[model samples]
Target: MKRSLSLPGIAYGGDYNPEQWPEEVWAEDVRLMREAGVTLVSVGIFSWALLEPSEGVYDFSRMDRILDLLHANGIAADLATPTAAPPAWFFRAHPEALPVDRDGRTLSYGSRQTFCPSSPAYREAALRIARELARRYADHPAVVMWHVHNEYGCHNAECHCDTSAEAFRAWLRDRYTTLDALNEAWGTTFWSQRYHDWDEILPPRATGAVPNPTHRLDWRRFCSDALLALYTAERDVLREAAPLTPATTNFMVMHNFDALDYWRWAPELDIVSNDHYLRSTDPESEIDLALSADLVRSLAGGPWLLMEHSTGAVNWQPVNRAKRPGELRRNALAHVARGADGIAYFQWRAARAGAEQWHSAMLPHAGTDSQIWRDVVRLGADLKALSQVRGSAGTAEVAVVWDWNARWALELPSQPSEEVRYLDTVRSWYEPLWRSGVAVDFVRPDADLSAYRLVLAPALYLVDDAGAANLTGFAERGGTLVVGFHSGMVDENCHVRLGGYPGAFRAALGVRTDELFPLLPGETLGLTGEVPAGASATLWSERLRFEGAEVIAAYADGPLTGVPAVTRHGWGAGTAWYLATQPDAVTLAALLDRIRTEAGVEPVLDGIPEGVETARRRGQDADYLFLIDHGGRGAELRVPSGATELLTGERIEDGVLTLPPGEVAVVRHPR
Candidate 1:
């Protein structure tokens, strides 16, 4: 709601590190930016070492020139604090500031994010630099937004050093307040892990065997808070200098990183931005893109920004596959369709040297002759064409419950099965909903479910008392809730529920799970009952004992053969469906189809089918329908007769628009 960047349309730009290039190329950079319609560029993100060559010695000449150049060219800036990578000189002055691995090995300062989150020396230096930057650029006309510390906790989320251990103790003391309370919450009675004094407690570092689940879970919470504390500290400094400017840090809500809980961090930010790249392993990364964008959008509760993504292959992955022709525009527009207000890539110009030289950029190393550069220029025009689409909002009828705290507990040391991943399980349900052409929004379990007709709770290993009540209450109301396997198994403290599995939902579900029946990898079992024929499941199964529930399906050959594998229970005015198995894609799609019909929750668009994604955005002038084709062939979409396709400026008098593979159509229907 509080976007500081007042642009003509959706922002189109990328991170610009002019320090990487010589001064001679600076003129051409802005010239090409103008040619490509670059509106905003993130500056000084990884320039800490160069900007502060010595301790407290400021060298603002380079950055000053960079800002001047961008301002002169009429481009806005999202100035950064450059705290992500502390200088080597600072590290040398405080070697202990370097992060320590879980095994107690001190990591060197060669890479970015090498400083420990809890180190006083690192914190002081970072804040000092931020203060200096804010004081200098507070009134700079080029500066539109303050980007606090690039992507917090990407590399060093957890630090096992002595300083971090002390900080962890302090954090725990603040949370638990008393040793007895801490002991009870942590269940320290088992394995003699109790703490009589706060000083005795330390982070869950490497041990002889599996560490305490509660200990690990709390440590994850502490690490996220520590990193967030770093962001808030810098943000306060910027706020003091530039009080009106909005501040935000880019979040990696994608699959790779899951350290910081954006649900906790979202409130602290004035704007929400996320960096996502298409994973090579996932051939259907397009659906994953929708999933990630939807989560970020819901966190923002409105439009967000795509801070960084690859124009081509990312250097970090094992096999960095390049984005096929037209894929770049497809990816960018997909984010826009999912409530992204702007689009930006990782870097403006490709790095000539360093760790991320191979990472794709707007201007590759091959210069303007490449297809990537051509596409970049075209995307800018395409964004400019849909200027009216900015500030549009997306609404969803279905919500997928996401709790980062639960994610931490689900992935802790010991569990039913390693394959029962938190994000994977959530996506198992989300993918089907996406393919079904249903628009989904992500929310915490305790968040208000009144807006949604259907809510999916998946992989919620740890649920607090409040969340448990909230889910039960939602089901008791008119909202149809789907409880997945491995959810509601434990409380917030990682303690297993006493009465039965999924203890949090037994009463509302009208059934109880006695035990878990985890299947081996590559193993699957069939189901018999109301589900589609050949409906089977993989990876997980559970023992169900019904109190008063209708069986939707029964396990045919698993450990709980002839027992109910899926159950539906009706409470007051709503319904709760419990799927005790990780159903195959076909089974989940079929099952969700039934649930959608019963709940009266349908896809966003009627004729939209699988392999093509569609989402509607409401604007003051009209309702915009985004049609993205990910299939192998062509597809046709019918819209209002008076609608106009914004991308191609084609007036749709016939109410039919043809979309080929890897293409996109944005049809604006007059209100």
Candidate 2:
């Protein structure tokens, strides 16, 4: 069930809003698209108001002309349903369709995604528009994929209104089946909050004290399902109209934005596509992009599409820094190396006005003679040369387990530390592998770990019995397991497991912690022994008593000095290592290097220095390795002498690859 466009080479180009400009501008857009080598363009994403002016009146003349023009120019269309934003008239007429925030304030319709997902009026109107668009573009020559509703849960993931409350109650009924079961799962006996009837439950609102953690967690899950239900209602209509056209919706799968469990959403999407934007201020933003791409690939179970990214300077960030001379090309190639079959930007041409007016584009407001334009043309040509790598997937020896449910649980109020974020801790573990040039895959806790030599779970705060058994079985079956601090303390309902910290994995991890001593801001703990000197634990630490596990590293000085800061337990054929504190970068790198050696996990490319990354895509006929040097400092790499270099078409008998800052090389070798 792999999904891709029929066109040749990596699909390029981005969102094209012909409705925003006059008909005269459409031709120039096509001509520039041809010059830029654009093979695909997503159209009509936010043109809901323009498409349908009134209740039953829709104007398709402009859309038809746009599709025809794109087809004439040899470009395919990922036609959008245009239901992301309801028309102002529709929202005004059906005011019940508006969403209410947690504080019980109705969200106005000026911004997009303001409709309630569970509102009957909104769903009906959205479906009507979707069906009309699907029927119109079903067999159109320009249409290749049906993009149903732009990024779900972007703004209105939760709505605390009567309609949503009814829908959430129904969703809970379907899950729990009865009130008794719901009470037991929620542990509602505490605080005299047990619900006698389904209607008594409510969405977690901002209260003087913390709301019930179970209720908040379930509400987040319900909101995700409600949005998914809306997506499916429109997707089914599209499938019925255009049975052959693949259906997808761009997902915003960034850190701290896991309201929707994409693992559940993946099966519904024919091609898992994602919208990724870099934090311009973060020096390691490239690492976040790679992690996001890897996650999207895992969700798709194969190659996915980079549906939306900025060429430079996105408007929403505090500091919208422009990309350097070669950074745009470097960024796109990074996604391609991570298994993105298509590289696309948010818009083909810069918007003259609106919220994203300052957002950079392929053809910026400076017209076709800009550095951005040149970079776009060069990337198109480079993608054409590297087309053979399409449909190939990157393989990894390490798997990092992620649970959106746990993330939801962690974000609830009243945690020990304000700095303990699920994604940040996960990235802390991933940085070591990334710096070592080892490719890693993100997986669910229940995913099969047989294919991986090492599995790392960093802040899995919520773990069910099955999750615990899975990790135990993996370690017992000869795979090294690394568990981070503040993990395994709660069950599915966010209830404490009671016996000790890290409740379920206590036996498997062979350690017990009686106290959690979270460090205050600007606080640090000294570490000594086998660990690196001057290395200190920051953010968090635990007082531990090892059970058959050896103390690898102990705190040199702190409230919990001489306690085991790190422990290793041999369970059957493998070992389980626990890090009771957030170690410094140097300590983490050393610990990961030791584990990588013990597990026999090797890097994709050896001797690759910092700022140089490598990813391999295995095809049936040959294997291609993509090496990217993000840093300006040059590095030399050894490669197959007789391999074909795709970028330069140079088949050298003695190739010694050298990359000088911001250079990318794709080498193809015979299988």
Candidate 3:
């Protein structure tokens, strides 16, 4: 695995926008940063309006001062291209730069990401700015990495104007080659939607005929491609100017956007980065963040960056709640515990005026020296002392296949319950592994499965023949497999296979499922044999007939009461288990406990309490244990003998380690 960017201790600093403040404030900002143990500051985010006020006008005088100030303070800066949002003048001059909504209404320049990615005017202007930034800042000592357009796909789709239509047609031609090939791939003959000419294809939006499934799918693909093309244009400009500095764009994990197919764009990035936000305080939140980090790390096959996070409460949600005292530190450490190399926040100073003025920031509107600022400084100090953890990578014995193609194909089907979401199912399986303290790699379906003794592919909806055969080979070779409901139901083209559900894995799983029942919201089905209270028995229930498998649990009530809800089958030296219904957390945890024991996957720590997560990473000679307390109250954790706290310099040997709420500790085992 490639090494991540994070050093051993902790990474310090937050967003810094010198453009928003005066020259005198820059010095004060640096002083405050140093005081807070801030080692890095992200500059130039949302500075397009200041950088370029008009067409053909370029200004970097202020940015130069900002860089000089940071360098003087010995701080590293993650510089942005200032291309996330073009100036209003550019959009006004080239009206085509405006994006059009799904209903065909052209968007105004009131919001960010309003520029149409397909518009030549926007692309040309964005590339020019990017080239200028790269050329000007390539040799600056303060600069660490180049951050491309912020969070690439906030816009759902782009303009349906003539320019976009022509580009869409070109994209289709490249993908299908000929009109006949396009017709066959989309299976357009079913709805008499066969296209005689490429021009017949129109952008799928809320406007026209509600769109056929094939066109809708292609439109999503086309939109993602367009955005990626935009990203590549800027990336090429930067690469030509400064090949040494790493180039990357912050990605949103499991977002509605098709950008998750980083496999298509991974080569363009020197380091993969993502912005993580969680809504719930449940254990799943940490698992989701870790999964995203693992995905990015797997993409580059190395360490990735935690590009953006809320220093406190974010303003985007309906209710913005600040991060509890130690939550920020705990969260940052959580990323490192996974595979994050670099850590940075969204904004350095809170906005003084505007929609996001109330959003979380490292420096509140009040100058500095607040509690938040103190925590920021402490985090910085910790990071500087602990840079030794940089090259550490997690040890994962199990891998979960997270395929975007399968996700898209499965959701496009008309029959399955909407409650059976792709992300939820993946998370359900992942939660157990995470809670059990077993590191997992969120790999692609085609990734080498031999490295893992256990493989979990929940909701493998779009199982191509090759993919299914791959799983079969793994099972035959003594690798345990677990698959859930709504799996093996369709091919890549969204067409259901005949015979029965789980068509291809029938022999491997040793079972056949013909009928699936969709339960309404809040409906409760029961599970036989000591099922936990509030366990969901009927989200997507299936009738099963075991060919060779033994039933482990069955429905306690309903027409299928006494039928199977869980089954296990032995195949070769390995085994296959099928979960026919969505169960509650307790039941899921219980099921995972059994699976973990059977697979012999070891946990990193024992006697860890709830809300306290444990993860371990090993260097050549030492093992590092990351203990994070996400619980409400402080914890007195017991550490193994002969270990030392890397952060606090305290020696521990099966003694109580005090951890305040939301606190984290990195314990290095004796060499």
lDDT of each: 0.90, 0.88, 0.76
What does candidate 3's lDDT look like per residue over 429-528, in tens digits?
8887777777787776666788787888887887778888787678788888887877877676666778886777777888888887778888878887
For each candidate, give its TM-score against the true structure. Answer: 0.99, 0.99, 0.94
Residue 534 alpha-carbon offset, candidate 2, angstroms: 1.8
Candidate 1 residue 230 Cα shift, in angstroms, is 0.8
Candidate 1: TM-score? Answer: 0.99
Our tally of clashes for model 3 stands at: 12
- For residues 320-348, what per-residue lDDT tens digits would candidate 2 score against the true structure? 89997688998999999988899999899
Ranking by lDDT: 1, 2, 3
Clashing pairs in 2: none
* Winner of 1 and 3 under lDDT: 1
Candidate scoring better on TM-score of 2 and 3: 2
Worst 10 residues of 1 by lDDT: 1-10
- Which regions of candidate 2 are displaced past 4 Å? 1-4
- Tell how far residue 143 is off in model 2, in angstroms: 0.3
